[model samples]
Target: MAVAIRLRQEGSKGRLFYRVVAADQRFKRDGRFIEILGTYDPQKKGENTNIDIEKVNSWISKGAQPSETVRSLIKRQVKAQASN
Candidate 1:
């Protein structure tokens, strides 16, 4: 089955939160996921994303594609890691 890395919505309506997950491409968004990779909180300022790069790399190497937004987040994480 095709796989993807994407976000799952959660938290209250006005206060949105999301979990970054690895799941089957055919599954509905926010439905069954293979694993929880990390989180994204847009409401929070600075450092709002937390993802396991090692796990993400493993998934990507295994052929899991990330959504557009998730792709950007991953880029940011990589830059952050490189600086520190």
Candidate 2:
């Protein structure tokens, strides 16, 4: 099964919240997921998201592809972590 790491949109409208998850590509965007890697709160700036880098890397190694937005989020998180 092709796996994809992507965002699962939640929360009420006008206030967007997201969960970073690993799921089968065939599954609907917010339908089902294998695991919850972390969360993203766009309304907040830096330090607004929390992701398990190890888990993400593991999934990637296992052939899970992350969506564009999730990729950017991962990059941003890495950059922020490096500064600490």
Candidate 3:
């Protein structure tokens, strides 16, 4: 099955949160997922994304394609890591 790394929505209407996940591309955006790689909190101040780059790299090496938004999130995480 084709796999994709994407976001799964959670929390209430006004306070939305997301989980970075690896799942079958055929499934619904918030449906079955293979793993929970990390979390993203837009409401948080400063560094708002908390994703495991190691796990993300593993998924990428395994041919799991991340959506454009996820790709940008990964980049942001990487940059943050480097600055620390």
Each prediction's TM-score against the native? 0.96, 0.94, 0.97
Q: Which pairs of residues have clashing backbones in candidate 3?
A: none
Q: How many Å off is the CA of 71 in candidate 2? A: 0.7
Lowest lDDT 10-mer window, candidate 1?
22-31
**What is candidate 2's lDDT per residue for 15-56, written digit by digit as tens?**
989999999999998999999999999899758989999999
- For residue 1, model 3's alpha carbon misses the true position, in angstroms, by 0.8
Evaluated with lDDT, which candidate comes out highest? 1
lDDT comparing candidate 1 with the true structure: 0.96
CA lDDT, every prediction? Answer: 0.96, 0.95, 0.95
Model 3 C-alpha lDDT per residue in residues 1-84, reported as the tens digit of each score: 999999999999999999999999999989999999999988999888999999999999999999999999999999989998
**1-84, model 1: which lDDT tens digit per residue?**
999999999999899999999999999997999999999999999999999999999999999999999999999999998998
Q: After aligning candidate 3 to the native by TM-score, how far in Å is the CA of 69 from where it should be?
A: 0.4
In model 3, where do residues sit more than 4 Å from their true spots? none
Supply the TM-score for candidate 1.
0.96
Off by over 4 Å in 1: none
**True lDDT of residue 33, candidate 1:** 98
